[model samples]
Target: MIAWPPKAAPRIQPIGAERSAECAAIHAASFLHPWQEADFEQLFVGPGTVADGAIEEKEERLAGFIISRIAADEAEILTLAVAPNWRRRGVATQLLAPHLAALAVNRASSIFLEVEAENAAALALYANFGFEKVGERKSYYRAAGAEPKPALVMRRVLL
Candidate 1:
């Protein structure tokens, strides 16, 4: 008989103010302009905000996080970041699946987010989740000493 390895099952939980530092760290490592701890603290307690983290159970560390804010029937994803050591290993997928369900429960009819035009990996991930490009923002993102980059505005309707 052959033995197969068990699939990875990441634990998903609501991120609180205490973990704002950790989330900030991950965001800094993943993005050019990352939100600070204070920003995360507010989002954690904000009425329309949802913050979720993916935990690596054995190590007891955050693998990734996703944050979004909903207003009325619409939701907008603020950011999705994964720890450097956890990228390309399905952490984003695990984080997004439950996050989407949570958004639906919060009465979001559709979700919107913007991804840098050159971020092929993120674009692919969003596309896999059925997000379609609705518009583009010229020079929507800027970096120090570099030319600004465009961002794609994407939307996905919930069931």
Candidate 2:
């Protein structure tokens, strides 16, 4: 069974360029096409990049991280991943909740993302938070352990 982080005391912190390597490692373990260190480095320095990490108190290790950027009236979730060992905890919720709230505070009209169509767990998570399918990209992602898969494009309008 997949073990999850303890839910009661998880914490979230802004992730900076210093932790790019660690973030890259976690991304590698948790994703099929994880971003490289250089990619995160660019993101940290890029015009609209914003990112955060979820950590358990005392250990200071990354339980999950979310990468997003605000562009005008929209916020895009570029990537969000939880360590395989940390799946099912409230870590993803913790990481995304504040970011989405912040975007709403900034008057963001909506948020959008693309995920592999077969990622049921992610689709459910996003759906629970009110994201809806807006479109699709054919063969958008390389499957977890197989060839590429179709991508579902989803969006959530801030109200």
Candidate 3:
């Protein structure tokens, strides 16, 4: 029997230092090189930084998260990840909405994020949200045992 996707929408909430371990776990499952809990802790304590997680209440698990830093009139998404089982289920979208809204409310004029050039799903998601390619970083991601990959910088005007 095929298992249907969860019917209940995941709740989006602010993520605190207490949830760093959970965020690290999800990051490990989502990325080739994951951020550690300590890294998340640093981000939590940083000024102008914000993070949100998508919590699946029934399972009591964090399905996805997005972290960003707002400085002056600009914001930058530092990282975004979704649990493997939660991909293609709107978890990332849910996590991003409120963070973007908060940035806009704070008077941010634009938001920027870097995505691996080959990540089609992320490219599509950003495009759907009106993000446009603005720049490229050469060999921005160096995963172990693989060739370094290029990163595309995408931007969206919030004002």
Candidate 4:
């Protein structure tokens, strides 16, 4: 989730309902429990939803994407995913920087997200960006053959 940016800078672009298929593809490839294309499409058109994708300029492919929902002065990051090939290359950092600014512009004073408790890289990245430990959701992530990792809810003051 905290993938560093690579040598080539990714171009950040608004992702609308039309790109739900591509978003679903990345989500399926990245998560154990992936949200479907319909889910992405719904979110894309949902009230207060904001979505963006990081595109690799070199290949003209999506490197990663982030989606969030804003309600009043608060916001929550729905998902942040990086393509397998783009992991550890800093796409998350690049995507989040501009996204946070947009949230502030939208008058969001605080933002939140949930991540696996064991995801050190993501925790570190969030911490670096001023997010703090908030609450936890037990067994938030589960697999058919594996134990679940608790989800840590983190919050950051954006404005």
Best-matching candidate per lDDT: 1
**What is the Cα-based TM-score of model 1?**
0.93
Best by TM-score: 3
- Report the C-alpha lDDT of model 2 over 1-159, residue by residue, as the tens digit: 334534555688778888788789988997867789988888988877778888767677888889888899898999998887778876787788887887788777899999989889899889988999999998777656777689999999996
- Going through the candidates in the order shown, the clash numbers are 0, 0, 0, 5
- TM-scores, all candidates, are 0.93, 0.89, 0.93, 0.91
Candidate 3 stretches greater than 4 Å from native? 1-3
Candidates sorted by lDDT, descending order?
1, 4, 3, 2
Clashing pairs in 4: 3-90, 4-89, 4-90, 5-89, 5-90
Give the winner by lDDT: 1 or 4: 1
Residue 110 miss distance in model 3 (angstroms): 0.6
Candidate 2 global CA lDDT score = 0.83
Please, what's the RMSD in Å of model 4?
Answer: 2.6
On residues 25-133, what C-alpha lDDT tens digit does candidate 3 reach at each position? 9889878888899999999999898788888889778888898999999999998988888887887777777889988987889999999999998998899889999
User: Tens-digit lDDT track for model 4 on 1-159?
Assistant: 344543687899878888788889999998888999999989999999988899888877888999999999999999999888778877888889999998898999999999999988789888988999989999999999999779999999976
Root-mean-square deviation of every model: 3.6, 2.4, 2.2, 2.6
User: Against the unseen true structure, what C-alpha lDDT does each candidate score?
Assistant: 0.90, 0.83, 0.88, 0.89
Worst 10 residues of 3 by lDDT: 1-10
